[model samples]
Target: MKTILVIEDDIGIQKQLKWSLSEFELVFAQDRQSALTQLRRYEPDVVTLDLGLPPDEANATEGLACLNDILNFNPNCKVIVITGNTDNSHALKAIALGAYDYYQKPIDADVLNVTLNRAFKLAQLEAENRALRSSNVAAQEIIGNSDAMIKACRTVEKIAPTEITTLLLGESGTGKEVFARAIHKQSPRVKKPFVAINCASIPENLLESELFGYERGAFTGANKTTLGKIECANGGTLLLDEIGDMPLSLQAKMLRFLQERVIERIGGRQEIEVDVRVICATHRNLSEMVAEQSFREDLYYRISEITLVIPPLRDRGHDIIVIAKALLHRFNDEFNSKIQGFSDCAMQAMMQHSWPGNIRELQNKLKSAVILADSKQISAEDLGLTAQSSKTATLRMVREQAESQAIRHAHSLASGNLSKTADILGVTRPTLYALIEKYKLLDLRTTESETQQ
Candidate 1:
């Protein structure tokens, strides 16, 4: 049974409530202090707070204070304020102060029971949603249930245990580095160092030294022998972010290191052997660079032994909402704000906006919105997004997206079993096969033998 903390001071009314709310595990408190004690002890999800507690029963002073206390102790707790018919002002004030709902008394058991049940159901739902988000976010710090994201994650799981040279291709701010870290965490070299260096951020003159280190007096700044990123990440992973930005002069040396598994530092003849798994990421098209003779083709092929393409936020469909919600939960805790969720207009705006800057843009918008939001729910205006900025989706586009998402979701639920997926979608097997091929989801299709087994 769910617990409800009842803060009614009147003995006769309390007795009436005890009988009326017999289905719940009720804890009674006549004043603010006792109510807080019962609140801490039971940690009840729902509370019936009478806005007329002793001493100040005529007014709502004590009752309002008690309501604030309960909310402060646990923001998620649902407080249903109880007030006299004439106490309309107090009831409104309580609601404004974060009470879930307000109730007018000459207590109707049936009516209050209905309200309590609704509150309990909502609380349960929010709890479950939080758990689900936590699990997804905790796993490799990757959040999204979209088909594109699922495919990427599954590929990572399959390849993380191996020592393949992985290349992550994505648009800027699409979380390529985050995926690199996820691979490192899942790899057998997880306990070893995971070094990351942005090739684009470092100067061309110093990039070689940064990657392969130098001996004492190798250059003006080289006073002592130093281990480079590759050497430092020995037995672990080295992420070369924006690898497309690497200078052509250094590309040949990099390719040599990949092939030889040894590096000769600047001003040093000794070939120091190093064992490191290289993971490269870039927003630039290395293939075009190779075609343009700007990047070495051999090096590109070496780094891309196993490539994973991260989908842009716009292509991720409902994943935008999933990521936004996860970010909201995080920013709420960071800002200590009671922002419950996004408004309908805000959600529509998010869905419509083309996230050219991707996850980085989303994070910045949400962080700022959480801090500056005037209401409990964030509005489109709060995110600095307008309806005009959103692209108008065609009917065909919407239908296709919905169908793809539904098929992918069902396919996953059935563990790639086409017959089961078809059954779940209330479709024939042949129709399901056609739809899967239409969406280019052949990669997720199960073989006939595997399905039979």
Candidate 2:
């Protein structure tokens, strides 16, 4: 049964309400101090507050103060304020102060009961939504509290509900597929299939058939009709990994399907429509490839309607430790070990090491450490990482150097288009411009431009 804390000063009315609302587990308090005490004890989900209590029973001062206290204790709790029929100002004030609803005195149990039920239902719905989001985050393999990773998670939250083609650009092992799956999990078509194919992993000869399916008897061993990744993911999402490496010939076919949302299998006559949300991920610089005519310009535009640039692991500060600990816990559970935590040396080593392979490297190192560790606490040696470096550069300087190097890299990859470089660097045009000046990148930009022409 749901708990409701009723705060009423009048003894007779208090008894009346307790007897009337007997279906709920009831706790009653006659004044502000007692009400607050009961609030801490029961932690009720809803409260019925009378806005006229002792010392100021004739006014609403004491009652409003109690309402604020109740909300401060637990903001999610629903509070319904009871007032006199003409006490319009007090009722609205109670609501403004976070009361869920206002009820005039001379209560009708049936009507008030209906309102209370509605509040409980709403709270339940909100709780379920929070649970789903939590599961989705874990499913995406996302674990971090750092502001940079948090911003990336927030971007996932904002774009998860849409059907636009999203492009994820980052170095390898930065969890692009994880973010892609997160988007699919939060979409309306989550119940359908989520199919992913790596364009670079497959040979060019088989890549086309893998994406658009093959008709029966279309090739040497075409004994049966087969559905492609796109068709299999109908009403869901399709993740094209390493899209930059897709063959130039297939890029034209892929571009047509993207433009038309229809595909015709090799040696097939019918144009089959597949309703899949497309997400492309790549470490290779597609924009520069487009400029060099290795990738089609139209295809680049088609795949990157909205792009999410994932910051590398080194840029995420203590997120490295957070992710490592979580992975440690998971590995401990999987391997049936009792490792307590990381040694101080191990933690320091993690913070100092530059994770070139991002989360994948971190996960692999932890897995190997768990297998090798004999003691309860893991040490720096166990994780296959060395102790602190002797270099004298401050962390801030290291970050600036990394940022400068990345900007120069993107400049070369993007052929010095400020907009494309900004997109690749995951910054606004103004911020990229400031970085260019700060890093003395103007000469590099000029070199890139001269080489491009």
**Cα-based lDDT for every prediction:** 0.87, 0.84
| Model 1: per-residue Cα lDDT over 76-149, one tens digit each | 89999989857487887677577878889788997798889988976875575456446442244777766777
lDDT of 2: 0.84
Residue pairs clashing in model 2 are none
Q: What RMSD does model 1 have? A: 12.2
lDDT of 2 by residue, 225-322 (tens): 99888999898899999999999999999998998999998779999987888999999999899999999999999999999998889988867876
Per-candidate TM-scores read: 0.62, 0.58
Using TM-score as the measure, the top candidate is: 1
